[model samples]
Target: MATVVFVHAHPDDEASQTSGSMARAASEGHRVVLVVATNGDHGDVPDDLADGETVVHRRRAEAAASNAVIGTHHVAWLDYADSGMTGWAQNDHELSFTRADTEEAAQKLAAILREEGADVVVGYDWHGGYGHPDHVKVHAVTKRAAEIAGTRRYLESSMNRSAMIRSHQAAVAAGLDVGDWDPSAPMDDGNPLGSPEEELHWACDVSEFLEVKRSALKAHASQSDARGMLEMPEEWFAQGFSWEHYIEPGRPDGMVTGWFLGEETVG
Candidate 1:
């Protein structure tokens, strides 16, 4: 079985983005490793977590639990500080992931890839999946490391514009709010088309994995509130969600799409 390593910008990003594929991969016996780029130290904290260090420690524990739920064997971090989104001003911090030397970060990730002998390395798209500076840096570093290690690389992303539009329409039909999701934003750095077509390499049917994903997201109580009851019922959540999308490396002609079969079948 191939060893697949997923590089992410924060603690819960794995759950938020790729938990289904991770679960399916591990269940199918592929060794899965989660490489979180940051400690999520800047995440929100509850009133009970008054101690600063304690909050960090708690978030780490939550991340660990989430990893376990997703069937990941290893969860390592680059141990960098979070670089809040661009234009936040705090991004100017000396130690933020955004400010970290790209070469240095790439070297560090390359070392991990070498030690793990990872066959497949997954990371966010160029837009960092949503323009988060840390996410973008993680993508850059993962890309560099994959190049250095000579391992196949993939970028995790949502559905293409048509699919996303359909999903949003479905959500709206189900009484879910679409006001917050902006479909017009540019998905990546180079693409000006805004909502350009996405090449999905693997579409993992993670409807069953949604619970695991939700639990994982719930684990990060600091950054977000997990108590929204949307129009889509829990049952719909299980059945409606069909795929975890991806963008493969070295394919510039267009978006290459497929599904993860827990093997090197090249779906």
Candidate 2:
């Protein structure tokens, strides 16, 4: 079985991006490891803080629950502070993931990759799907780490623009309330949310693992209200998330029908 590792920027990013594949990997008996880059300390601060509990502590707890739901065999962290969205003062913090030296952070992630003997490493897109500061850092670090560790495969997780357009049309036809965020809008850092569908190289049908993905999403209760992912209805969730998209840095080829590693995992 493949030792697949997914590197994400924050706690709930795994839920929003690659939880389905993580669930399916573990279920298929492949070793699955998740490396979250930050403590998510800058995430939504709820009104009710239990005495001295900090946002970092709360997010770590949520990440643990998410890990269980997604069937991740192991999880590690880069131990960096969360960098808030673009233009936020948190980006200037010395401890923020975005401010860390790329090679330095990559060395840390490469050590994890070497330790796990990772066959494949999943990371964020070039613009991190929406150009979030931490997510962008994750992309750079994961790429460098994969190279440093000589990982067999490196995939940048992304959204399919055409698929999203279809999803929006489907929601309209199905009479479901569409999400609040506009997928087409230029995000932070002034880049489009995801790569064009034509530039994508791989697509995975995670429908079988949708239930686990949903559980994983629910596990991030702190962001449930702040984020729009879990707000959608069951059917819409399936339609919107059933297919996960990816890009290959080495190859700009069009997408092929396959899972993260290959077709063998399906059987």
Candidate 3:
């Protein structure tokens, strides 16, 4: 059983992006470790917090609940402050993950990777699925961390742009309400969502684990997006989130349907 370490930028990111894979890995008896780079201090502020409870504390508790739902074996936090969206003043904070020195942050994650004996280390794509500032930093730091730790396989978690567009078109054709979300529209850093289909390496079909994913998302109730996702139509959620995409750097272009272990389960 190989160990897979998923490095994320915030508390609920793993639930949104890689919870299925994490659940699958744990179910298969492979160790699953989650390393979050930030405390998520700048995420949505829930009004129901206890007297002295801060967003960071609440977010970390949410992450712990999420990890339980996903069957994650271990979790680590870099404890950096959240760097709010691109232009937000939080980005300039000395302790923000976005403003952290790349090498230093990488070292922190590399230590976790080494300790976990990670065979496969997962991170976000270059634009971090929507170009969020901390997410982009996660990409950079994870890349450097993987190199520093000499991990055997490095996979980048990402959405499949063409696949998303196809899913959206199908939804529209079926008269489903997709709201204002446009896959081709500019995101946080003026980049379209995720990488092109051709750029992806594999599509892990986690359809069977959809319930597990939803439960994990539900654990992060403090985040507005997570709450919104839980309220989305079940069919829509199944259609868009059943398959998680990834890019294995240096791999050839064509996409394959399989798990991250390089085993081809389906064509």
Candidate 4:
């Protein structure tokens, strides 16, 4: 069995993006490690968290609980903070992940890869899975770290350019707000706000992991709202949904999919 490391920008990202793959890998007897880059303190703050420290602690607990459901380990805060959404005006926060030194972040991720002897490293696509600054940083650092660690790197994207239009059209035809969104906007380019099929790299059938994903998502109660629920279809929730699609970076040419055993490294 090989070791796989998933580097993410925040707490809920694993659940929202790749929990199914992680769970699948673990169940298959491969070691899976989740390296979250931020403290996720910027996530929805509860009214009860009058103390900033308390908020961080609470979010950490929530993250831990969420990871438990998937049977994976969690790590975080190597040195950056969540960079919130783009153009949110708060993007320039002093502690934002965007501002973190790239080398520093890369080194932290490299350490995890080395320690875990990771055979494969997974991160976000160029758009950072929705273009969140932190997610973008995670992608950048994961690429660098995989090189530093001498491991294969995978980029997780939602859909390809073609599929994006198709999914959007379908959603729009279904009366969803597909047109009201613009992923190409400077602040929103990374996050298209709706499903785009072209963005997908390799779709994993995670129908079984959907409940686990929902449970983990629900763990962050402050962040879970009606809109978030509406964003997901009840059928998807019930029948399970495809959770992750990944793009392998450094491949010579053409698209490839499946569990990477790190054969490329054995020169």
Q: Candidate 4: lDDT of 156?
A: 53
* Model 1 misplacement above 4 A: 50-52, 153-159, 169-177, 185-198, 225-232, 235-241, 251-258, 261-267
True-vs-predicted CA distance for residue 105, candidate 3, Å: 0.5
Q: List the residue pairs that clash in candidate 3.
A: none
lDDT of 3 at 51: 96
lDDT, candidate 2, equals 0.87
In order, candidate lDDTs are 0.72, 0.87, 0.91, 0.67
On residues 1-267, what C-alpha lDDT tens digit does candidate 4 reach at each position?
777888878777777677787877777777888888887766777777654456568777777887888878545446466677777655788777888888887988898888888877887777675567777787788888888878755555444444445555676789876545444433456345323443344555666677777777777666654228536668635433454566665455443454443344321
Clashes of 1: 5
Ranking, lDDT, top scorer first = 3, 2, 1, 4
TM-score ranking of the models: 3, 2, 1, 4
Error of 3 at 183 (Å): 0.2
Please report the candidate that would top lDDT against the real structure. 3
Weakest ten-residue segment in model 4 by summed lDDT: 258-267
Question: Considering lDDT, which of the candidate structures 1 and 2 is the better prediction for this target?
Answer: 2
Answer with 1 or 3, whichever has the higher lDDT.
3
Error (Å) of candidate 4 at residue 173 is 3.6
Question: lDDT by residue for model 3 over 43-119, one digit each (tens)?
Answer: 99998999999998899999999999899999899999999998999989999999899999999999999999888
Give lDDT: candidate 1, residue 45.
71
Tens digits of per-residue lDDT, candidate 1, 1-267, equal: 878899988887777678888887888788899998887777777567754556568778888888888889998889988877667765888878999999899889988988998878887777676677898888788888888888765555544555666766787898976677645546334332113465555456777677777777676666663323223477655544445677765555454444544434433
